[model samples]
Target: MRVGAHVSISSSKATSDSVTPPHENIANAVFRQKEVGGNCGQIFTHSPQVWKHQEITDEDAATFREETEAELDGPWVIHSSYLVNLCTPKDGLREKSIDSMQKEVDAAARLGVEYVNVHLGAHTGAGVEQGLENAASALDELDVPDGVTVLVESDAGSGTKLGGDFEHLATVIEKADLDIDVCLDTAHAFAAGYDLSTAEGVDDTVAAFDDEIGLEHLKCVHLNDSKHECGTNKDEHAHIGEGYIGEDGMNAFVNHPDLAEVPLVLETPNEAEKGFEWDIARVKELREN
Candidate 1:
C-alpha cells in the first residue's frame, strides 16, 4: 500500500537559492516525506485557515515534479482550504468557496499533483437535496486540468455538514457533472456511524461503501483512527491502532484485499512523540505480505 503524511510545504530558508523558487517551495514536501519513510503524501498550498494560495513559479514547479518523480512512489494530493463550504446557501460564501476551489485545482495542475481533496462542508439550512445540488454545481465551475481529479472527502456529520453518509457522497458524484471521486477518512467514517472498530465492522463498512459509491471511485483513504466512538460525529484523529478503531480494526482494514491498491494518507495527530514517522512505521508493520 502507498502511505504517507500531510506535510508542510513551508521552506526552512527565507529566500530561494540557485535551484528553487520561494513561492513554489513545495519541493520540501518531497524531502519531508522521504525523511519520515513515506512513499506518497498530501500538502496544503497555503494556510488552510485563510483563503489564500501561494503562487507556483514554473522553475519551482519543474523542480518539484522532477524531484517527486525521482524520489517518491507518488500520486500526491493537495488538500483544499478549510474555509471552503461547497454546500453553503449564502451567495457570498458560495462564491468564495468556488474561487478557492478553482485556485486549488489550478495549483494541483501546476505542481503535477493528481488529486485535490476537499470537504462538501455544511449545508447551512439548505435542504439536503439543494445542498447537494449546490455542491455539484459549484464543482462544475472548475476548469480542472486533464490529469487532475477532485475528491470530496467524507465528513464527520456534525451539525449540517454533508458527506457524512455514504449516500451523500454517492449523491454528489451522481449530481456533479465533473468526473469526481471519494476520499474515505476512517476516523470520519467511524464517527459518522459506519462501524470500523472490529474486523466484521470493517468488512461491513467496505461493503456498504462499495455499494453506495462504486469501489472504483475510491481513489484514496485518509487512514486514521478515531478519538471518539463509532457514531459520535467527532472529528479528532488518533494514531494508527491506538484509537477507538483499535489494533484489530486497523489491521483488518489495511490488509483487506479490496483496499490493497488504494493509497493511504495519514492525517493523525503529530503530538505525543508519535508523529507521521512513527505512524508510517506503524502502517508498514500492519500490512501483511
Candidate 2:
C-alpha cells in the first residue's frame, strides 16, 4: 500500500562533477518523501551510463544502504532506463538491451530493490509477434537476481510497440522462461483499447488480464490519467481525475481487492505545482468514494 513518485537526487541539483551520486541524493529524497507523507519511494541507481559502461564500487553500495535505511521507512523500487529496447530486431540493440537488463538486475540486488520495471519497446517493422518473441529472448538471456523480480510495463500501443494489450504481454511472459511479472498502467491499458472507462469495460479488462497473464503476477500499478481519449494509442500522461481515464476508471483499479496491497506509483504531471501530498490525497479520496 506504499505510494510515491520517481524522485531524482543526483539529477535534481548538480553539475557534471558537482552533482552528488544517485545513492546519496536518493536517500535524502526518501526522507523528503516521508516528510511529504509517502510510505515508500522509487529512485534510479546510476546515471545514463550504458549498461556495460556503468560501474558501482563496494563503498558506494554500502553508503547507499546506510543512507536509505536511515532516511526512509519503507520499501524502495528501481526503474530501468528508457534506452533499453528488447524488441529491437538489430543485433547490437538487442545485445545492449539484454546487457542493460542484466545490469539493472545486478544494481537492484546490490541496493536491495525488490523489483525493476521496464517497458516493452516499439518493434519498428518486425511485427508484434516477432517483437514479443524478441523481448522474451532478451529476457531469457538475463539472469533474475535472487531477491529481485523483473516486471514488464504495459505500453500505450503507440506506433509499432508491443505489450499494448493483454494477449501481447501474456505472450512475452509465457515465452520469456523467466520469472517475470507486470506493472499495469490504467491510462496505457485504456488507450491500448482495454476500455476501462466503463464498469463493464473495466471488469472485462481485469478478467482478461487474470486469464491471460494471471492477476497474481501483477506486482505494481502505475496510476496515470490519459490526456488522449481511450484507444488513441497515445502515451500522454495527465493528472489524476483530470484526464480521459478520470476518477471512475482509476477508482475501480486502485480499489480492486486483488491489488489492494500492491505498491502504487504516480507518474503524473504537475507534481511540483500540485504536490504529491495533494495528489496522493486525491487518490485516497477516490479510493474512499
TM-score of 1: 0.95
lDDT values, one for every candidate? 0.91, 0.77
Q: Clashing residue pairs in candidate 1, if any?
A: none
Predicted model with the maximum TM-score:
1
Q: Write the per-residue lDDT of candidate 1 for residues 84-145, one digit (tens) a residue.
A: 99999999999999999999889888889999999999988898999999999999988998
Question: What TM-score does candidate 2 get on C-alpha atoms?
Answer: 0.88
lDDT of 2: 0.77
Question: Top model by lDDT, which number?
Answer: 1
Give per-candidate clash totals.
0, 0
Q: Where is model 1 more than 4 Å wrong at Cα?
A: 13-24
Candidate 2: residue pairs that collide: none
Q: Candidate 1: global Cα-lDDT?
A: 0.91
Alpha carbon RMSD to native, model 2: 3.6
* Model 2, span 61-118: residue lDDT tens: 6666776677655566677877889898989988888888888889889877788888
